[model samples]
Target: MTILFRLGTAREAFDVSMTRVRGGTGTTGPPPPGRRPERRGHLRRIRADRVLLLVAAPALAYFLFFHYGALFGNVLAFQDYVPFLGVSGSQWVGLAHFERMVTDPLFWNAVKNTLLIAALQLVFFFPAPLALALLLNSIVGDTVRRFVQSVVYLPHFLSWVIVVALFQQVLGGAGVVNGWLSTLGLGGISVIGNPDAYGPLVIAQLIWKECGWATIIFLAALSQVDEQQYEAAALDGAGYWRRLWHVTLPAIRPVIVLLLVLRLGEFLSIGFEQFFLQRPSVGPETGEVLETFVYYTGFANGDFGYAAAVGLFKGVIGVVLIYAANKVAHRLGEQGVYKA
Candidate 1:
């Protein structure tokens, strides 16, 4: 009892000395004078706000510079753009270029092709990622699922040239299939250089190249779904399909809507490189889209002003589409693409 008392006394003295040294008069007293409540609160708020601003600045600058800066350059569409004269010096054509665009048969053809390809993509390509994600989610083994994911994602890193070349090598005249067919004394398919088959081929290429990567977003959303909810549903006698329909889908629905809206914004942009490279072989009837139209008009036909107008037209349509898509998302009980 005496030893315990001495130890306790020593501890108290040490604590008292430390407290005095640190300017705390009592054990439960406030912090030192240098770190007052008002000043600390100010510093904390300042730091937090600074951190938030730092995080937000890069994305804001990126949009301002690339998106809005490019938007400013759209003025050339209204002017007779000249190489010698700057955008400021260029003559204002007002609605002349827009008039030309509407009247041009080539422009109309490009618009038709773009819409057809985009629709095909929406119908065929859009659902593939969700299907893939669902299939992946069903896989029980991590090793097998990861292996499949990696293999599938490999094609996304491949360039447009490489993807087209891969298609050519497999389906071209002297390709593997044709070579096998020749050995069996069979007829050759003329799909390689034909414009008629361009739509299907491009869609197929898009699937091969982008589907796996696209599944990544859906998979991420799927990963966040509550396992307990699935368990509860299963306990309630919900089967796999029921759980998926009721639980899994509802969880990932927001992401699906978000991706759909973004895709709608890119509706007018069905890959320039792919079309440009294939156009030479298949001709413009099948390969022509807004991007390619702009390229040919400005560079091939040497009509920069008309090409800019076509581009401007596409841009406006994309903005309208995105706006509409966002509105639809809001109406369907989902958060839209943007928020104030």
Candidate 2:
């Protein structure tokens, strides 16, 4: 009671002093016309914004639950996780699994495959979407353009199983290529099951599946670019390629860099389902990427602890890579995805 009284007294005194300084009545009339509506306006804004907050609440809750909750699972990396015993009851191994992973030849092989695939993606898959976006941007007809876009984007919606099956139908042994070759008296190309071709195959598949979908973002960014810039470039005697080089590329460079940084961050995630499905036939050497290695470690070999450790390591590496990429972006005078 005494504390409340003292606080109230202090507030009252402060209010009196402020009113005296401002030449306004302490009880408040219209708050000098400027300040009165602000408080009411703030309350009105809160009321209006309440619905938006309520609408977004579910997504916020999902992010908190799934993202933040799964983050805690990283603890298993440092522990000998006994599934039956649960996390709290598990033995603390303190990077034993990490040590084992570094020593394991299979783990090293998986790492090598992942890095090689990532490099391939960076080299080939990265530029394809940008090129597609540029090509799409050149189209003057809306109906024809949308038709092309719909056709291009359709592959992205297809399931990995459907995609892989389609690939097999076209390229697998005894499929269309083999049948065509048999008719022509020529040998078929063994792409599907060939270890030598596996890396290229995955990279090509990733490009085909994701290239069009990835172009959506680039196209969006391209759409925001000023048409007048192109007009000016043309007036200045620039060709289509030159205008694109000087104007269009500059406009979308930030977005490209941002996407590239994000891709760099996910370099290890060559993909789970694709590699997992293909690895069985292609054998471990060509197909055992990090994600599949994790799945096999956990489910196949029943080493949940070790698998979790591997995953945790990958996640940490991802975070570090993203951070490093962002730093590099800043150094290059580029606006990175995540600001430091």
Candidate 3:
């Protein structure tokens, strides 16, 4: 009887300990109260948001099918790709296309032109939006501010073709400016077909068309700035310029840094249509960029493999630039396009 009682006590103790650990029966029971409801809540939320998920399905599918799927074609960079033979039967030339690209004078010229144009844009075009945003944000009247925004943003909606045509009408050799110059007994200056002025002209066109649209982002950032900060600066006897330097700029600095980092990533991809349409006017020496170079090489010269190599090289450079820029942003204590 004593032995049986001891064994029963030991068994009971074991069962109690096991139940405590399991929060119920020894083997299992329902999950702990907190976890089961939390899990159920998560599943419930997912079910509730099924409609939104359904709405997003098409866009997700498009990106998966088109953008991500197209990444597989990068293999053409290694192969001497032929359309007739397709990817499977193409002869692999390894790095031969890349080797040729490195030694090609035309390729180097395109790089030079691309860098020069990109530099011009970074220096001149990049700051225009910020300046305009500041000017717009200073407006005391909402009506005037909104009207100005609409006028500036209207250009962004215009197609590149329409925008280019409008610029030609205003600034081309035989256009409005030249017409006025001729009436004043002055020589009509070359702008449209002038290779020397092409860089500046491209920058001008970019600013006119896109500067206002870019300003929208800056303005949005500025809107988020605390009005109290500006008021405090004013109470401290800080003037407009001083307040702008100290308060306004600091508030939007993060946005500026983020945009700058993103711009660096896309530094080489200065639009195909813009350069292509203008290339004939300025000639390849002035206007050939990586985009046009790729197009001409692949479609015009039918050198698909070499073009793919150039494109792949460009993509690698972009990745490096974005990574470096993001690192710099993190070092400066700013969140860039992504966290470090």
Candidate 4:
């Protein structure tokens, strides 16, 4: 009986192999007994996965309250909002704030600065993580690669305040490098708070802080690439660059395009904490962006209505940009943030 069972198994395996060789779908096994149990068990599995749902509850609630909840206050944009009078009591001025935004010179300057910083980040900071991931993936030594990855990823967990402080300590006028330059009788260079160099400095800070963290996705995508593809390419006389261009890049192109689309959606939101902390030092001329503009207009200057208008404007633009980017991604034959 055991010999008979073994013969039957071998015959089944051979049949499946022959089916695949004939370009069949390779699912030559017996059909499933029923689908209702699986359908019914989904709810039971959900009950079992309650712990995961509970873990995600806080984050879900946070976004619900802070993001969607705050959206109601956008009505303040069209009102001459007074803290004491509140949104309900405030007189509705209609498109006054938006009209002011269009004519405000400082607002335009802030927009220009924001665009400049965003462009710099897209051009320089965006590709740094991808390059790092590719280089790290090339390292064959698991121990060395893991050690290097850990060291690079550590900076991402640091708070923006801590990151800014570290930069100031190392690059401030009286800081370590400048002190050394002074000792060497070469004039100390100004970087931390210098307006002319602010763009590069901020981009450098972003790269240092987030580049490794960003690689987590690319590395995941790389790991999913079929090793057999690389082997086949090598057998076909493809060199390193050719194999990378043909195999590795094509495998990860979906992930790259998805990330690029998301990045473009938030092109106007450079950041708040790092720039905010350095704003006073660099002065508004160089450091002011949309976030800082909103903060100063709302909190510092008591122009809540104007600030709300600008914030709402940014949100609208963000939604539009995300939709447009996703459309472009679809046109290019890539599944973007969502399916069509």
Going through the candidates in order, what is the number of backbone clashes in each? 0, 0, 0, 0
Ranking by lDDT: 4, 3, 2, 1
Report the poorest 10 consecutive residues by lDDT, candidate 3. Answer: 1-10
TM-score of every candidate: 0.75, 0.77, 0.80, 0.78
Write model 3 residue lDDT over 1-340, tens digit each, in one string: 1112323433344445445555666355556554444446767878867999999999999999998877888999999999999999999999999899889999999999999998998899889999999999889998998899999989877877888899899998779999999999999888898999999999999899888888877888899999999899999999999999999998888768756755665677677788988888888998899889999999999999999999999889977876675455444432222242
Give the alpha-carbon lDDT of every model: 0.79, 0.80, 0.82, 0.83
Q: Select the stronger candidate by TM-score from 1 and 3.
A: 3
List CA RMSD, all candidates: 15.6, 12.6, 15.8, 11.5
The lDDT of model 2 is: 0.80
Report the C-alpha lDDT of model 4 over 1-340, residue by residue, as the tens digit. 1112323433344445455455686456765565344455767768867899899999999999998889887999999999999888999999999999999999998899999999999999888989999999999999999999999999988988999889889999889999999999999999987999999999999998989878887898899999999999999999999999999998898768766766786677678888888889899999999889999999999999999999999889978986676455444432222232
Two-way TM-score contest, 1 vs 2, winner: 2
Model 4 alpha-carbon miss at residue 271, Å: 1.5
Residue 191's lDDT within candidate 4 is: 97
Best by lDDT: 4
The residue pairs in collision within model 2 are none
Ranked by TM-score from best down, the candidates are: 3, 4, 2, 1
Candidate 1, overall lDDT?
Answer: 0.79
